[model samples]
Target: MAKKFEKIGENLEVKNIVIHQLLKDAGNRLVNPKAADNLLTIGEKEKTFLGNLDKSYHKKSSPIYGIFAEENPKFRDCLIDYINGDCQFYDFSINVMNHYKIVLENTVAATGGYMIICEYRNIITSNDLLLILMINNKEGFVIDEKSLTLDNIKNLDLSKVDVACLINLTEWVNIENNLPSERKTYLSFVKGMKEVSYYFMSFIDVDNKNTSTESTKRLITAIEAYADIEQWDRNTKINKKNKVFTYCHDCIDNKKEILLSTISSILNPDNPEHFQDFATEEAYRVSEIISGDKVRMKFLKTITYSDKEFKIEFDTKLILDNTIVLDGSGNKLTIKNISPILRDKIKELSNKNA
Candidate 1:
C-alpha cells in the first residue's frame, strides 16, 4: 500500500527545492551582492515567508498545509462540498489532471519571475487557514508585474500528480473524541475523513520518521478492524451460493389399527370383557374411516380364552363367529360359559406397549 504513494513525497520535495533555488536566484539578480547574500541564505527566505503567512492567517493555531492544483474542477468541487457540509470528505481522484501538471510547472516559474504567484484563502479552522493557487503559462502573464513569459511552463513533462492534506493528527483525534456519539451525521463525516487520511498515509513516505503516536495507532487499529469485518461479510456472501431443501411425511395412518388394539388392552387390564368396547371407542376417535367389519375382526383376533377345566384353548374367532365352545366335560356350551385365563395375552401386549 505504501508503494502507491511512494513518489508523492519525493515529488513534493523536489518541487520545494526547485522553488527555493529560484527564489535565491531571483534575490541575486534583483538585489546588491551583499544584500542578496544575506537574503538568499540556505533556508532564511523560505522560512521567513512561511512564518509571515502563518502569522497573518493562523495567529494562534497550528497551520494546515494543503497541496493541490488550482484548476482541477473535481478537486475544487469536492473541497467546496465538504466545507459546505454537502459531502463527507474531499474525494481524491486517481486519474491524472491537466491542471495539476500546470501547477507543478508554474511553482518553478513563479520563483523565476516568469509567472506570478496567487493565493486563495478560506477558513478551514477558527484561527488557521492557508490556501495557495499556482497559475502558469499565458495565464500568469495577465498578472505578472515584470511581464516575464515562459512558454517552457507548458513543456514540463509530468505523468502523475498527487494531493495531500497535512493536519495535526493529535488535534484531529481530540476533536473526534469530544463529538457526541449520538450525532450520527458528524460521526459518519469524521469516519469518512479518517478513511481518506489512512489511504493517503499508506504511500505518504514518512521516511523512517517516528510519526506514530498513541492516538494515531488506536485510529489505525479501528480502521483495520473495520476492513476485516467487511472482508468477512463479503466472503460469507460468496460462500452461500448453494442451497438445500427437506421434506417430511407422516405414516401414522398405516399403523392405526395396531396402535388402537394395543391402547385398548392397556386401558381395560382387569376386565377383558370391556376390551372390544374400549377399542371401538378409541378407533372412532382416532380415524372416522375405520370400517365396522374391520374393527370387529381385529377385536376378535386380539382376544382368546384358555379353559383350565378341560385343558383346551378356545379362540375368540371361533366363539364369536360360531357362538359356541367345548367345556371341561366335552359338552357344547355357549361361548360365555367358558372361563378365560385371568392373565391373558392382552397383558403381554399391554406390557409391550408400556
Candidate 2:
C-alpha cells in the first residue's frame, strides 16, 4: 500500500506540543479547579485540542475515541496517566498510544468520524439550536431545520449507521421565549432536516422486502465496486485478496520499494506510522466512489457476448469456501461457473476503454 499519512508521528508531535503548552498556560499549571472557568477550559478543549493534531486531521477518529471510552475504560485511565506523566509522548507515547490505536484498528474510520460528528453535534445542541445558524460552530447540531425530507426513505436496514443524533430541529426545539408564529415554522423545519440526515447516513439499511428484489443485487454490486475503485496511488497498490488486513505494530520493511514499483508511488512515507490510515482512507475513497448512484448502477454491468447479452454481476465474498451449484426448475436454469462469462465481458469492456 502507498503510505499517504503518518498519524502517530503527526499526533505525537502535536501531543507533545499540547502538553508542553498545557503546562505553560496560566490556569492549567495552577490546578484542576472544577469551578474555575480558566481551569475548566482545559477539559473543554482537551479532546478538541488533541483532535487538532492528527496528520490526517479530517480522517475522522471519533468512533475510535468513543469505543475506547466504552469497551476499555483502561484507555480513559491512560489519559489520566498522561496527566500524571507516567507516559511520555516522546518515548513511551507509543506504549500509551496503544489505547487509542486498539480502538482505531478495530473500528472503521467512517464510524469514528461519525461519532465525532455526533458528539460535536450534541455540543452544538447544548446551546440554542434555533438561530439562523449565523453563529456557526458555536453550539449543538447547527441546522437549518426549515428544509427537511423523509418521504423517499424506504423500509431498509439501518445497521450501517455510524451514529444516531437526536437533533431537535423543529421549531419545538426553540427557546420558550420565542413567540408562537416564529416558533411554529422553525419546529417543522427541524423535523425535516433530522429525517434526511438519518436516512442519508444509514447507507446499508436494507429492508427485508428490498433485500429480495433486484435492489439487493444492486446494493452488493455497489459495495464491491466502491471498494475496488478507491483513491490510493494505483502504481504501488496491493489489493487485499478478499481477506481481512490487520494493523502491524511495527513499520513495514519494504514499504518504499514495493510501493515505488507500482502505481502506489504517488504516496510518500518519510514517516511510516501513517500506513494504516492511508490504506484505510484509500479504501474508503474507493468505496464512496463505487457506492455513488451512477457507479452502483454499473455494479450489474450488463454485457453483450456472442448472440446473447446478460447481466454480469459479481461479488467477491458472496460465494466462499465451496463450489457454486446450478439449480434448475420447470422454466428456469441457474448455473454456477460464471467466471468465464464474466472474464469475457470484462475483456470486452477493456477494449472499449482502449
Q: Pick the candidate with the highest TM-score.
A: 2
What tens-digit string does per-residue lDDT give for candidate 2 at 70-129? 333453354346446776433233332233233334333311111111112123223222
* Regions more than 4 Å wrong, model 2: 1-75, 78-308, 316-354
Off by over 4 Å in 1: 1-127, 145-354
lDDT of 2: 0.25
Candidate 1 versus the native: TM-score? 0.17
lDDT of 1 by residue, 115-168 (tens): 111112222322222222222222332222232222122222111111223322
Query: RMSD of candidate 1 to the true fold?
Result: 36.9
TM-scores of the candidates are: 0.17, 0.19
